[model samples]
Target: MNQIELKSLLADRSPETPAGRIVRTLSERGSMSAAQLARLTGLAKSTVSTALSELKRSNMVVETGSESAGSVGRPATTLTLNPEAGTCIGILIGQSEIQVIVADVSHQILSDATAVIEPDYSPARGVEVVRELIDAAYANQWRSPDALLGVGIAVGGPVSPITGEVMRGGIPNWAGVNLHEMFGPMFDAPIFADNESNCSAIAEMTWGAAQGFEDFVLYTLDLGVGGAIVSGGRVLRGIAGGAGEFGHVVIDPDGPLCRCGNRGCLEVYASFREPLAAAERHVGHALRIADVVRLALDGDETCRRLIRQAGEAGGRGLGLIGSVFNPALVVVSGRLASAGALLMDPLAESFERFSLVKGRDMPDFARTLLRPSAFVDNGACMGAVGLVLRHHGQPLNLPH
Candidate 1:
């Protein structure tokens, strides 16, 4: 089938068509057996079989060998969308960097690349850098840009769900920028957009720490402290797109000024920016957040102390989230999460101390579970890809 047909099937939200349901399910879940597809799509076995037959005949589906489902019978054959049918692009616009990833419908990553840019880079500069990166990503691959199905963008700042405009605070240069308008002309397919934290949550739900749980929270402790709330298997992008901006939450009205222009915001105290600066001074040179995390993991007391302190501060913010949502699982994300127990122990401790419901007071099953993100450097970008795969956050008036 052509790209239009494939896109139409994947983007079709109607539940009456078995073919559309099967295509969308495979796009979201990657490879699966007919039985699994039937269960996930809530279609009868005979209907799924018919749809699969039609899809295979149209070269839209392909057999991916077999996977043992740990059953007594022989392994069931798996099926996935034909990788040659179409491709998707995921771009991440970070504070000081830009990343691009290319993947097929079968969830196979073809290329992933990043470029470090100066801080406060303008939107024009960002588009240029992204174009270059995307070009380089496909330079060696056999796939052509014409096969691209859609583009998903993960912006560092909050994006209005209604307007596709970036909000002020996270990325100063990106504030008020219309992402769909900025990136639309560059592609021939539909464009999807969301803030980085929300994209990270999508990545977690699809492939990482929060894989099985529908109700959870993703708390990111990085140069900035931000998070995303997931309930009923959907990320809660608040009205005007300010929902999970935990970092901007004002904790002290009279405290120091924050980058977001708010005084004593959670990010001012919990972010790793100040700690990284301190680590740089102690080491007599500049260091990335990962460097301090590595040093702490290697038994550096100073680095360990910094991480512990940040964790404690982060936990206080997380505790507030706990009191508010009491999510079943909290996935601690960002570069600091790489420190492992050095960060998690203190964070969890602080969370227990400040939260209204103490873990000790609840049974093991009732206690909130905390885990680190599965992806360290690429979660948001990959989540951008998930946005396209799952057909989430599609821009208005976009053609199928």
Candidate 2:
């Protein structure tokens, strides 16, 4: 395989060539019919056909499978980049866990693994653990990391845009650590990093519920209430990396203190942390967010009531987000989202009650659609892989 040519085309953000556009589009959207590619790339059918022919001839693109063409005609041929072209790594440095995903250019994940770490682990220690995980992943796979194109890091919190540092308020020990500096020497390929929520938004937009949406909001109603905003097919990472911190939004001045060192933050009220504790106390055992959701789904009244209350509380935060962005779609994610309608129904009602743009006032098409995430737990990690595929040409930069 011409790894050099494929790598060059992947890095060429501004394609200027039909083949380049096709490769980039495939990398971002995974497998699709040639007609779908032509529509997505906005190229003439003849132009796409000609470029795809050359790409296939060069062993860059390959036919994956066939899918029926709706209720008419024969099955359309599905196509994707050859899986042997090259690989990309996506690492998630989360609050108390680290995840690694090795994937090929065709969007197939080769390996996925996670390791739990202490909450306040040092950045250097975190790096050591991540390196170990990556090494183990490749040891099991036949593919060589020699053709690695790039690496994407998804941090649990916001990463500074200008300084490239992990900002305060996300990971307690990660604040101020430069992500690019920490991971640059570990790999020869370019490094891309972003907030985990933003990565999740990319995952949703690329392969999950937010697919076909260029604009939407991802409200994560997890242990902590956080979110990400996507505008024009790009995540909006605010100036100081605090753009989508819905959790830290202060709703009251005299309430309890927040982990971000703020008082009366929406997280204090809306996050599932307190409710999870209440459920655990009621059951006399610790319960994961998912476990609580499952219990609720199984008709445990205490768990069900806790989730409903959490959803009602979470909706106020969504209402705040809705008032500001007025997004067309809000993909509710995180572990709590697994509760489905037990969370969404009340959340939607609360959103309509609190948001400035009332759902009753808008037309059916104009009203915002609230949808659950496709992946309850690993959306952000999958998005970490997308970070490399979607934004490989750009390299992280910080002041010297």
Candidate 3:
């Protein structure tokens, strides 16, 4: 099949056709055997076999390798979308950086690049930097931009689900900016956009910690506190595109003001921003969150204490979330999550302390499982790629 046809199949929500089902499954799950594909797509073995043959002939799918299924018979050959078919781009517009990733239909990353910019950079500057990075991505790679199927943007702030406008309360300079209009003219492919946390949740569901759970919550603790709610296998973007903005949840009416112009919001207390600053003061030098994590992991008592305190504060907010949704799983994400057990142990302890449903009161099967994100630095960007592959959030039309 051609690029347009492949895009159509991947974008099709209906799974009535075997080709569409197989394509969607492969796009979401990467490579898998025929049996696994059948199980995932809920198609009969015979039907899958027939469809595989047709797909192979059309070059829509290709054999990747073989995996020993621990059976007495021969190994099962893994199948994936043809890498030569088309590519997709995932971009991250962060507070001080822009990242771009290029991947093929088979989920193979062709290129990854990032450019650091000043905080509060303009959208025009972001576009220029992104264009440069995209050029560099394709400069040495065999893949050409002509084969791009779609573009997915992971914005640091909330984006209006309908208008693709970056909303207030995150990324101050980007607020009320039209992302679709800003980035649309740069490419011919369809553009998709979502908040970084939501994109991170998509990445988790597709390939990371929340792989099997359809209903769960993602709590991000870094320079900012944000989250995403996944219920029934879909990320919940509330009516105003503010569903999983857990950080902005008002905790105390008379508390300290937050960047979002609210008093006593969860982020003001839980986010690692203050902690990072405190750690810098203690060390008498500038330090990124990762640096603090490294020092903590290296047995720096002060750094460790700072992280632990941040975790405890974060857990209080998480406890509130648990009280409301009571989700089966909570994936701890963001840069702080890279601290591993140092961050998790205390966070879990505090969660148990503040949550209404104590773990000690419930059976093991009924307890919520909290796990750290699988990705350290790339989850949101990768999730942006997932947006294009899964066609999760499409941009609205605006006058060019």
**Model 2, range 185-267, lDDT digits (tens) per residue?**
89988788888899999999999999999999999888788889999898988887788888988999899998878899999
Better of 1 and 3 by TM-score: 3
The Cα error of candidate 3 at residue 189, in Å, is: 1.4
Model 3: per-residue Cα lDDT at residue 90: 96
Q: TM-scores of all models?
A: 0.94, 0.96, 0.95
Please tell me which predicted candidate would have the highest lDDT against the true structure: 1
Better of 1 and 2 by lDDT: 1
lDDT per model vs. reference = 0.90, 0.89, 0.90
What TM-score would candidate 1 get against the native?
0.94
Q: Which stretches of candidate 3 lie over 4 Å from their true place?
A: 395-400
Error of 2 at 366 (Å): 1.0
Q: Across residues 289-366, which tens digit of lDDT does each residue of candidate 1 receive? A: 999998888988999999999999999999999999988999999999999999999999999999999999999999
